[model samples]
Target: MTIGSNSPTRQGQLSVLLAVCLAALILPLSFSGAAMATHTIGQELGGTAAAMNWITNSFMLTFGGFLMTAGALSDVFGRKRIFISGVVLFALASLGLSVAPSLGILNGLRAVQGLAAAAALAGGSAALAQEFEGHARTRAFSMIGTTFGVGLAFGPILSGFLIESFGWRSIFLSGTLVGSLSLLIAIPRMTESKNPDAAGFDWFGAATFTAMLSLLTFALIEGPANGWTSAYVLTLLFGAAAALIGFVALENRVRQPLLDLSLFRYARFVGVQVLPIATTYSYVVLLILLPLRFVGIEGYDEIEAGLLMLALSAPMLVVPLLAATLARRIAAGMLAGTGLLIAAAGLFYLSRIEIGADTMALVPPLLLIGIGAGMPWGLMDGLSVTLVPKEQAGMATGIFNTTKVAGEGITLAMVNAILAAFAASALQQAISGKFNGDEIGAAARHLATGDLARAAHLLPGISPETLAATYGTAFDALIYVLIAITLLAAAVVFGLLDNAKPSEEEANPVVSPGE
Candidate 1:
């Protein structure tokens, strides 16, 4: 059924479409709010550092792994049917999360939450595409894009308020309320849409791809903690490589592949795809790392940290809308590349800040980061689907989001590993000739959590100044690492994204034969 066709029931399409887009907004709300509440959850659950990381990673891994398969399922079944199912599943998982008894159960429920999210996002985006056309479709997507930025921009603050007043469980409970409302609206107003000639499911391809992401994440998160050369770590790494190779081969041979390998031929599309990965590697890294630094070292509460985070996210609300407006007048590739360059500059500025720098000192760099983040956030999603045929919208949206969450999970895990190693190295270097092994070991454990007072207790003979300096050195090292990676990613973006404007045909969704 074409969008806006004069059918008896089509009058409600606008409300149903907006409801789906708003449901997409709920995703980042939960994820980002969880990020803000991670420390509290860990303390309450008596979870170790590694277990805490798993709370987020487990969800991301399954979300990314199941995205394509879910999108394909929607294509075969019906968008409305799959979309509603996803909402119900997501709501149930969130409700379960609010009352989880242990860290293990919470992690399991998070994975279930991610799977449901995959189904909801894929089906929702596909439905929106079917419900709107051309300029109207772009505007609908723009609203979705704006919701995405605003949700992320405000998530930490919202989560902080809820966690402060009601506890972290309220975050999940809030998501459940929103999900139920979406399901209610979607059931009656939403029309069912699917590809009439959708191909059969490629189960082998899906399995191999899922294995690849899962094994790769397992290796990255576990390797540093378990000793990189340990048998289990090495096995996971090699298994991931094998799974990746198997997935590629299977996709190439399959009649109906999970991913269309041919899509990579569009240099612009490849360039657009890379932006999310780069943004997560750089911008989201700060989202995860900065809160820890603020709370652990700077002596701030969760509420204060969230307020500080607002400095980093606030520009996201305005800049994406601005960037979206600019896209019509400028080439998208250049705009995205420029945005990355600005973000790299922001990262460099952050690296220059002293370890004892107060929250006030962070505002300028945070604003820069937010603006840079918004620029690409504005264009990448719309550009991703525009480059492909409308028939492939579901798959494209799936891959697009999978890259985002997977990149975020993988990069955050890597950063955690880096922080642990660097902090230890800095601690040892600071006390090289001045402390005994027992004292040093105690200091190192305290330093791992950025606890200067306790670490100083272990080194009673040392001056408070020396202990403070040692912690500062470790914090500075992380900033330097982030700076280096952001710069490298910017250079990659500049070299890869094409500066030429796409033609009208390339920019619009193709009317597939079935349509």
Candidate 2:
């Protein structure tokens, strides 16, 4: 691609891209790796079910909350300043995570990692906007998204090897090495820039918005554990609701808003936002879900589970890039919509396979889902960049990423809660009144996470065979919901995003080799 050409400007451009992409890998690698590492971490750290959930949740809460604020800060302060600071902090945090003495300390470090990740991601992305133009910008943003997919594709395998060979701390060790390299590459080569017209920080919007997401996630994650109708969960839900209303009101009144609520007026932007939420259920949830099922229920060991995930996620290596290339000629909306329907079909295929089914039974559907998810995943960052004016790149990408990451975080929590409920119901019916609701819910929650040891511990009297069957039944039902979500997203994305192409006058010509 023209991005890697030897001209001095091109060389500098490539350096910026490389640094950002490398930094981009840390989030997905840590996230997908942590999901697979849950049991191993618990074995050493004495994790409770709640603590196990927080392994991912704690990171995402801060990550999702701080993204927009970080982006706006990048635009206000120098992007290079924020970017390098974030990278350095991220490296230090990873080093701390490797030797943390307990789950509490480990989770605290993860939260700090999320805060640093937000700064690194927001600052670096905005900086790259200063370096590229037109089609180059499109490709640059797509590369970032693809880099993340690549991390997701390989994270489980890497974590499994690191954990089995050197223990869980090595996962954090691996991240530290990567962060150090990202910081090194970025320090000398990356340019510093910011929006001249951008105003002071929107503290009210920031505080209210972050508070809303933090409260909502807490409610969702705790609802099942505390009982949905429990006073504790209900109060959290109320606080989250109030915070949301306050956030909306505050955003409308603020001069320089953290979120700029007016952006939703664009049909294309709305369509673009939908893409991430849709993929969360269709693709991201599976990253957490499949590992649990394979390792916990199917009797696959950690490495085997990671290998099985390879079939589901390896298309990140090729398919997303293919989708981006295809977007040049085809309507991107049509491409995304068609791909999601393919995913819905794949989910349906997956729903039929029984427990302990052979690899061939699983591989085909997983591949289809990976291929389907690849299309929308590839389109996100590019569309986000194009929709807003270049000056607001920090805010635009920040909001887009916040939506993407926040959606995944909330959706993961919701999917787990829903699956636990569905599995609990299935367990109750399958066993013909052997257990009460509390017992069933406890077992289902653990089983849903693929913590077979805990699930068994929760239901000492229940046969392992019965628990496995119950989980299998719940998985089928959950897949049905995912299928509906994908299909709905397909239609909605197409309807809103079709005919969203730029006018010929605004379109840039593809660059030629001689130039």
Candidate 3:
């Protein structure tokens, strides 16, 4: 583990290491690209607005739900075997997804894709950790981190081009190719690795956790379409509660638990973990809302919206590296808290923006958000584990990551619900005296589904100007509420977390458990 005493990597070892890192990087790249192309897919697929959210949620639900179990499975079985299996599954799913004829089929395939991604992501990183040691390993991981950042930063831009040039299907086709290439490299080169001491798989824990998340997400996404108190929504809410209770009980009784409940006792762990939830919620909510604003409301195409998204993502590329340096000088808690406040400032600024604002008007807030997002993703992650026992570091990382993705999935559904409810109500009230109930309902349905043309067709009696104003008012209110929440989260971070400096070891740890 020393710097100079590092053993030289064998000729082909570096290639295998790099391949594993690339495979890991490919998941985020593909997912982000798909997100950028969502508007195009929605237009072609002919689904409700909520269905578009489902496409993303389906992936996140499985990815976050099964991540810990997937990582453990890789340890118990063989990392190479799991990694290649995941690659194959992901490729096949992407292929099927590209040709999927209905939203139902597409969402099902996306769920499969997420499951595959979880396995590939966990196994690939574990393979890299197992294959190299000391300085060589450090460099290998640094490459992995760099690739990850680069992939996220570039994904939307590339997706924008591909979606414009070829179509949305081209996005999945590229993902299939990347998965296939990774599979080919892994077939011959990936070294098989497993933890000999790893215990039995926590099937009960995984099942309960997955069920809990899926149910909660289901209720949120469906609540607006079906009334909030509808039987379906109520059933899902209760089901999620039951699953959560069962998951806690099961994990406590299990021999090798999937989630260690004891770790939550650390006040620092609890406080630092909040940053991920707030940061992830803030980022993902905008990812969905911003594109809808640009394309659905403002008449920009997919390509234009994708390019604009770079303003939000580009800072993520460099800020983390800079923030890591700052970790050595400033307290991790303070750095993360300050970052949250900056992000809050950006969100508040964005809330004041006119609904009809152009791309140029968005850049400053997006930059501030990107800067804010970058700091916590690195700093909070470091601090979360730094205050914990070394033995529990892996579990802590797992929980932190689970929070990030799971929180994103659940919150996205909530955000979608909020938008749908507010917009529908606002539109209904705006046209109350002008249009009949039937016409108002029809227009609301069309608008809610992102079918602005259809809504226009149904609302001939209403002025387009009036319609735009109604929708804008509702959307702006959502942003205003989100701003309040962001600022509140910043306050919590500043008040609750201790201003403790992270150890040098914490700043640049070799292994990230949930990566």
Candidate 4:
């Protein structure tokens, strides 16, 4: 019950893992559910493209911004204390989301949910390291990954059923029900733990880093609508740059900085940073992008769209296993580099497909992309640790994990912004100055969301077919950019990781919490 008290039974430990797994289930579901439900959220809530984006960005932003801080808190305070608080807040946020009357309220609740998610993952995973040992600990930790994959693979189908049967609010309601069950199971059995040698809390460093991420994200999301050259956007960018400078200065001076700024000097470590950025555009972006394209632009229902998405997600279940096997024989960089090229090819193939093509026509490219993306999935975390000195492993893990979740949030925002800009440019060129600047900007945002109907409302005489064609063209251009990013990451990884010898640990990655 208290620090290092030791819960003495396998049954109790498993019970605790069940609770963690349940919480894990809610994490990915919340992410994919918001994506699948964004169009519907917009239909009922009435938000601009930038505003509707808050549906996903608000959640990822706070989750990433606070993730490392939450991990440190679990060590200084008590693991169970922090975890239970997180589960409670996560549950309450879900309940609030179920009855949220406006988009503003929904996104606000989502931001709270992200914060709570960070706490739950940090505390729950740390508690596991205390409760189990050796192989049991590995097994327990692996369950978190398995649970996340399951939630992601099934989230769309489940959320679609909830929406069609009970409307969009039910997605959050599902979170409420699961969170309550997790709380009930974990409370009586959970034990507390802490690191007695933990350093003093770095409040200033945390604040500066979070401010930097927040300002940059806001600038990216709002820049397309406000015009990239607008004074408001420029001011936000300037503030973000100032915050970055302040954060770097603080980290350099602090006794125990949040991030080890010197890690940037290592080629392998810098190359490791590219992995998450590559995946965000190559695969993660589509988690939201395809669902919107299918359901919003192509006139498919939730069920139909979810079913089609299976082609994209199903390969993840098995490919990572093969990737791990291959890593034993081949260098991780070569294996993952090859995979990125494969994914890039898939993107090119996907770009060429006609809009509203049949599911059968779409399956090959989507499946190819999934298989390719899954290869690097298990290698990234391992490389992050093995590339650095063994003494610096902890810092490497912290920095890599931050890049993963926080980097993911920022990258998603950038992808959304770029997509909107491309779509707006396409729209403008098609009509050749028929629409005013405000109308063109608004319509472009709508088009990016795959809301051709709302876009039609903005452009009165534009036929649906023509609008769909324009959207497809813009989307194709975005895919080209994604392909370029992926290939560039592959080249960097192959060159850097070549000098680093392969570790046996590469096959079984050691991930941080809230993965």
lDDT of 4 by residue, 270-371 (tens): 767777777777888998889888988999888788878877777766766566556667877787777888889999999989897877899999989987
lDDT of 2 by residue, 43-155 (tens): 78987677788888888888888888899999999899999988898889989999999999999999999999999999999998888877778889889988998898899
Clashes of each: 0, 0, 0, 0
Per-model CA lDDT versus the true structure: 0.76, 0.85, 0.72, 0.80
Error of 2 at 238 (Å): 1.4
Candidate 2 — worst ten consecutive residues by lDDT sum?
A: 504-513
> Model 4: runs farther than 4 Å from truth?
1-13, 129-142, 264-268, 381-398, 499-515
Tell me, by TM-score, which candidate is best. Answer: 2
Pairs of residues at least 3 apart in sequence or in different chains that clash in candidate 1 = none
TM-score of 4: 0.90
Q: Write the per-residue lDDT of candidate 3 for residues 1-515, one digit (tens) a residue.
A: 32234356464476676566667666666667767766677778877656777778898888777666676677777778877888889889999988999988999999999888877766665666566553444455445545666676777778888888998888888878887877777788777877666677788998898899889989988887677799999999999999999999999999888787776665566676688787865665776667666767677777788789888878777876667668668866677778877887787777767766776998998888878877765566445444543333334445765776678778877877777667778987876677776566556644544556667777786666666677677777777777777677777776656455555334444323321
lDDT of 1 by residue, 20-94 (tens): 876887888877877777777766886555677777788888887888888888888888888888889999999
